[model samples]
Target: MKPRLAETPVLLGWAEAPLSPWSRFGDDEWLLDIRTAGRRADQNRISWAVELPEGAVISRTAWRGLHQAAKQFLWSMTTNPPTGRQRLSPSSVHNKSSALKTMIRWMALDGLETFSSIDAGAVERLRAWLLVRPGYKAKSITANTVVNYMIVLKDLYRQRAKLDDAPLADPLPHETTYEAAGLTPATRGSIPFIPDAIAISLLNTALQWVEEHGQTIVRAETIRREAWALGLTRGARRQCSYHARKALRRANLIGPAGEALLGAYAVRHAANHLVEACYIVIAGFVGMRVSEILSMETGAVDYHPIGETGVAQAYLVARLFKTVDQHGGRVERWIAPEPVVKAVELLEQLSASLREASGRRELFLVKNTQYGEIVPVTQMHIGWRVNDFARHVGVPMHEGKPWAFSSHQFRKTFARFIARRDRSQLFGLAEHFKHASVAMTARGYVGSDFDLRQLIDHESRAETATALDRILLSDRLAGRMGERIVVGNARFRGRAGEQVRRDYIEFVLTETDLRIHACDYGWCVFQAETSRCGGEEGPSEAGRSPSVCLSCANLVIEPRHAPYWRDRRDRNSDLLSRANTMTAAVLTEAIEQCDTVLNRVGEHDEQV
Candidate 1:
């Protein structure tokens, strides 16, 4: 008999599978084909590696015992559903198994190798160890990473009953995964919204490209394909000789009604740029994930009216693969603006030849560089395009360095643009966006596609900070709330209007728990308990309901907002002359409300 080391892994062969589900794999391997795993590219490679410390070989019994537990964890993923079991993908498998591997390897060093030896105290110790390594300085592990490690322990407890070397009791029974790992709202990270200048510039350039050069790019593509199909072209311009370029150029490639595309030598590269340009327009306007955008097929965009209003709204319909299992994630819709719809239509044309060639319906297909076969473009590809597009368009620098653009920034930025104004301007900031009709822009906010409220609140606070910064410098202000602010600022800010330092204002902004919600007409210095137009979450829920806010005490009408009120008074007075008796009463009341606002700021001709 041989002595067993406490550190050696053991008992591998206990995990087994039936022939029905095992038919796809060889006797020794369980390889997963990730082609249909809601991914456009192969993303992760999952495996387990176990051994004793200092290069010592793990004994056969010990290796199999740990392997048996690892295999049982893997088997739990393969179970058929309606059984409340989850099917794993390469990404999830990689995340879960990598956690398991790290835990076991670290455990061996501590002289505990078996699942039976891992207790609740051991699990808590493992979490603490993962978060703050013994030798490393505060190279803090992210909340997500720690939470992922805790999940491995929780799962081990879940299948303990089924495994031969399973733990005797639940190792994480008292603590939930997040609680044990110390993850909370303050800990989880979020990608920041794109800076305003960069976003507006990027979107404007993208829209211009789709509007002006879209048909030219599509025409160029059609000519290249027609030449290839007729055997006039051998391959790309570089692959073919100069003779091919001259020959294609001589064809005059009259598109539709005598319109011609670019010179033959430029066709291929222009088609590629055209796709990137469309990516910015669609992704910026709609706030879709890069993967979701790549999954789209032809005619995925449409303008449909919601109710009897019959005002058309643009939307992109695509399946979100983030929650993919054997049953995939739900279909997601985005309230796209007109620019998004235009970009989508242009993309359909630009991608038509390649889509037909590949026999795949995905709109974001590109030719594989090495193989010339079409495949879906990955996030890395778009990430490169984002920076390239920024450089190409000369997007302005932020704080001295060129602003780095990413696909993730658009979603956060879009959420802020909506939240900052309570979605009053939603997509209709005509000065910036050159938006469509008011009715159409108004419809951009109402859809099943948008549910980023928590993120919006976070960003809305940021927007409020900017607003307060500007307000603190202003000498003249109006409304009851504005009067209070003026009196409040006079104390520390000095009666001479000497500027208050921004850091001091920010300190007060945070310390007092101040919230400033801006609207199209004015600002609302919100105190949820006293709000008239719905409180707390009300502005977000009602899309800022400025009509109701018009009478609220929280309203602060600045000098900048007086023009809107003056215009309102004039328009209502004009309407009263043409109104019938019942309608006349409504117009008279509207005029009175506007007069009340205009008189306070001295904008009205007649003072009350």
Candidate 2:
């Protein structure tokens, strides 16, 4: 450098008659120097300017350094799990890097090189300088430009240089913090409206209508025949495979009897609607996710009834369809319900006539139609049919947008229903849903924290009510035992007639409530003992048994007090105690049902 000036260098003023850089290079080629100072009447801040150059030039060394750091930082950002790719993608990198570039241009306008060259004091000064520059009032350019600049500057300083004297090491510095543009919170997009319950009914109606139409009638029937066969054949894969093999060996395409039945039923039937009905019931009522129901084989369901016709039961076993890891593979689970059994039974009845018609049971719905021969009823086919059915039903349709009705929602709904009915049975619900943890299922699918808390609180209250009721019942029985009353069937009574005086009477009442108190006390005790003592972890042992009362003491009365002791140890006391326990169990069951219903309501509200 030819004797660089030590004093603050003066820059050319716009008042000093400047020529437009755009004259020669045109607007695109003219480097838009967004950095300028004191052009506006307001306070001092960064300003914009256009710098003219001689020829086609490589980037300055400092510029290259900034670009390289940005590229490296970008690469670093992208190097994360694929699941998080959107948040840390190359596109995000580009946005961040672009901001950095603007910042670097500002730095250049301030006559600085390699942001690392600026110490703590210089950074302070540069920030002060930025406040007064013109074009700094532009919000996007000001905020993001400054933020990206500081970030890249800090990162550069951290990696390339170590300076204990850096001003950034201080608690705080006054500078504009620029963040990426999209980082700010904005209004969320409106949730898409899909015709819900009514829409589904309409879709079903439409499918029935489409089946009645001339063009698709035969194809519709063929699909129904196949779907029915699928529904009818319920066993393990091996069983299905064996049956399928046998059917293939027979190879009867449209048997005469089947054709005759089809002709007879043709006017009244719509096969597509029947197939649609099968899916809707399977995917909806059974709570199987769409993929699970679609990929389900004939062997997945066990159609055999556990009991009489109305008291039916069936079990379904299949691998869960959607998983994080495809290779992890095959999560085997089962669901059993009477309603599910009934639905499967109906489907089997419908497909009964077609079993003899197909020898090559490639899949339940494969047909040699005009469209093609032996088409598998895949997920795509199901999705298409559902959409078409929706359209036919006069429900407005979108091409690829997901409808509110999906296979997954059904599963969620099922879990919600079970949770609503029996909250204490969360573990059981977890098992039914084949979830790894009750907490996971609850948190993931359940509603707002307030609602969940209320549900749990309701459950707790119900349980408390039940326990209190039991204690009350037990107290009544103990009090009755003192009277020595006997009756037919409920005749038995326990001992301790004379011993049960005023104090002992109080003692019996106390003992019945004592067990309930003991549990509450033990829970409190264990929590306190472990936390206060800071000793061994995990569950504490049960406390000792409570004192016995007139209801439970089993004390014998002598003949001397025979008049008072008559029939004191009769069966009534034991019967009353049993009754008390049963009442508690029933009350507990009712509470559980209340909990389940509340939880289900919560889930429904969340979806809404």
Candidate 3:
């Protein structure tokens, strides 16, 4: 450790003058930029603020050791991490500090006063205690949670030379880190996706508030904020009651049916609900991390059109806080649909007055300021508002209580919603979630939410199972897979009679190496060996498109898909009418393929 005066401790970060990575900060609190600080920003709150633990929370000897270890650990992380290791992310530093604090408190419980007391087998004792530690869950804390506390204990030992009252020796000289905590490879937590009906109700109602009443709520809130700012609400007597009632005649806070939805221009309480609605619309649809959405400024939403595709996708531009593993705070954008765009636009209009007055442009701001300072609302505050919004709209109760709403649940729920209906889900969700595997879902949630892909994959397989069952049961199916399923059912008809197809489907699904990729165009009974699109590698994303499935031997065109093929044929014919020679040839071939399927299903004369 670098020698320093007692008055200028290392935890304050480089004392008076700043050093590399060590910013000018204090012992009590340190605020680091989310852009450069890696995962430091926990929520959409401003730059991450890691506060010092109070000394009285644990024994004085343990507190000194922790404070010393934290100072050296943070200094090493910020200035010089161990060789071959990059600096720890600010959030990582925050977590270690948090874990160590918990360690000291737990040590205090054991009547241990100092880190040096945790020598040799005492580490194992701590691990045993943690294994049975109570949490918010019914069972003892998962081994995964135990890992957080165990790693910090290792840190205190490894850096003993530079720390005061540090551990006497390494805690895990013989055991692996996970071994020390009993964290098995499979000991992980996976959050559940929201139920489908509730998800629909929540999103539809939220969007309704944004699209229908958003503008009025914003306008009305602006008026009220301005009025109160100008000290207009100081009357004790009902001096303006007569004039206020007359002014109510000009109020325009009416719903589509012209009902007084805002109650005579009252919008202060409405603004609270409107903010939560905006949160729901943006977070629910785009699946943005709470930090990213809350970090949005007034002009964050923009139109980004790819002229080549003729698709104008709305984008929410912001500093991505989770990119610190490669780079910190990357300026990126998520593909925001129309509803998301509208929600952000409404927030801009609603917060216009506050942004100008407070001079901070955070979209989610505390309505009332204390001591003339503006404050950004935290994620927990948003949760409370969402509960109120749910009650106001009569969202269904679960187990006799309103369903709990959370930031991650929004992303997970969005995943399942898209998984069921959107074939282009992977690309969109990857872009939105920041997940490299499925979509953009990972960027911020890499530490925990990457496992969410398991849930979506689960949803996909269930959907495929259902589609496969439907196709096998269809007597009038067409295409290669359709013909094969029909013939197989016929071959078993003599043995199983009317239930032959059902038995056949059950056998194939359970016994055979069958894979199905169902889409709006049709189903593709995919085989890696014969697949032209996937080409023996596995299921390629391109295999789901209509063009790729058209000529593939794996294609399965059920009778139900006749209307889709007919509509597609008509649209392509219209394009062919004005196409150049080369394009016209391609269109002609596509039309011929559609005609072949139409003939096979005897849909050439079907109304569709």
Candidate 4:
């Protein structure tokens, strides 16, 4: 009898195929490629295929079909790529798998078997069930999470539709159907920038410790100092360090006197905590993602000339995983300021031994023990180191808890600082942050509550007050001039003048602080929207003429205005001298008005 062929599924075997030079494989050739891909994909499917939670069981028929679909999905996700389409990252694959598992579990619970049994009603029921169900963390399942599940189901159907032998009866609900299912949109919160004092306090505590124990054999102390310096100076802390320090401190390995005991007992283990602290500075100051910062290789920093300037600028070449294309490749040249360069250099020096032993080019690795077992610093480790530092330094409390420092917060704080310093350079900020547009930079980094209105109001009031004071102190106008002012049919003097002055002073002192501006013929108590003067509407163009302001009811004659009136009178007098009988009448009328203005100013001066 012939030897039994391995019972490997076509999709699983395909996923295991080596991805290379056969860029133009046809459908038949691709099927053959799957055969050549080997059994790793089969093994992977076996491992993750039917991982159900305790007490969860499905019908044998349902399991067979569901398992086949899942295997195909996982295999295709890894191996098959549509031309020009980017392959999913490992994290993306994991997330999709998790969603599928949840759906399968729901299918078992509902007693539904096979894709044909899943309809819109089944999906809706699943959504309702998820809404009431509690997550592993015991919190109510969120609508956003439900939306994700719906997306996975939709993708599962989409993949089935592409296959020659699909298992589904009808296509799943449209993408829009999932969207209209009442999922709450996610809201991004504002950036939280720590106060300078708090940052300084944390740094000072770390520095003080480092200074007190100069050049010690305790690896923890050395790592702690390096981490603290990085966090405080470069704003580079790892996500792991945020909460990692708490566990270390609880272990009596990361407190004020923990260093001494740590030195004697677990020096090697303590080294990890110190390494975490160093991450804080790099993340916080450099404003790079935790993944990018951690993935930095040895000698990532290099000096390059900045434009035509003789000064050499430091640049850090690092992989940017978040914004990578389909190929999972992202490289960015970040401008490294002095502090960042220094911090990176120090990190290199500290991790030198560990890097050599591990034969890894990554900048951040720690020795596990005396035997020199090396491991890459993880996000969890960084969290512990940061919290430990914060706790030791007595960082200010918020909501009865010490302020939790995380890598995300560090990036936000960095953005906030840059935006606060200069809002006009938002484009430059966008470039530095690698944001797609200035709008995103503004929305994410800049606060909406900037106080520009108050500043403008204050400046306007000051300018008005200065103009008013100049007119009040002029030689032409003297004491109590507001009382003597007169216009067309209105006269303001004595009690009226005193009232006007009183109103002016009160207005200036009040919160509104209304001010006078030069209007058509005279001054007007107009301040954008705060004008108090009332007058009949005049011709639009003439209404704002300086000549019209002269006869307005709001006009106030003073000694300072005498020269202005005199000039008008002299011009009118000259016109009157050579005027014909018809024009002489108009000239006389104009001269008389000028004389009247001059008389008001002279009389006001006499009263003083």
Q: Judging by lDDT against the true structure, name the best candidate.
A: 1
Q: Go through the candidates in order and give each one's C-alpha lDDT.
A: 0.64, 0.37, 0.64, 0.52
Q: Is candidate 1 or candidate 2 better by TM-score?
A: 1
lDDT of 1 by residue, 130-213 (tens): 877632246767777788877777666676555555577877777788888888878776687787777878777777778777
User: What is the per-residue lDDT of model 4 for residues 481-579, given as tens digits with 9 covering 90 to 100?
Assistant: 233322211322344455565455456647554444432123454433322223222112223433454444344455545565667778888888888
lDDT of 3 by residue, 1-608 (tens): 86543324553444342322445422434544444311223521222232334444455655555555555555555565556766666556665666666676666566667777787677877887787778655678777778777777776676565455567877778977787777665655566666655777777788788878888777666555444444445653343433433443456456423455433245666777888889998888766677677778878977766678786656788666663354446666776766677888888877777787789887887754546655677766677788788888888877777787777788776656444444443324444333333322322222233444555555556666777667655566677667777776554444355476556566766797565665556777778767767645334553346777665778788877888777877888999999999999999988987787777766754422
Best by TM-score: 1
When sorted by lDDT, best at the front, the candidate numbers are 1, 3, 4, 2
Model 1 C-alpha lDDT versus the unseen true structure: 0.64
* Candidate 2 regions with alpha-carbon error over 4 angstroms: 1-269, 303-313, 324-331, 345-371, 390-409, 412-608
- RMSD in order of candidates: 8.8, 21.9, 9.7, 19.7
Query: lDDT score, residue 199, model 3?
Result: 71
Tell me the number of clashing residue pairs for each predicted model. 12, 32, 15, 47
Error of 2 at 61 (Å): 28
Q: What is the lDDT, from 0 to 100, of the residue 423 in candidate 3?
A: 41
Q: By descending TM-score, how would the candidates be arranged?
A: 1, 3, 4, 2
Which portions of model 3 miss their true places by more than 4 Å? 1-63, 111-120, 131-142, 157-170, 173-187, 222-246, 255-259, 262-266, 305-313, 325-328, 369-373, 399-401, 417-608
Tell me how far the alpha carbon of residue 80 in candidate 3 is from the true structure, in angstroms, after superposition: 3.1
Model 2 weakest lDDT span, ten residues long: 516-525
Higher lDDT: candidate 1 or 3? 1
Mark the regions of model 4 whose C-alpha exceeds 4 Å error after superposition: 1-46, 49-57, 75-85, 132-136, 164-182, 186-273, 326-328, 367-372, 422-608
Compared with the true structure, the alpha-carbon lDDT of candidate 4 equals 0.52
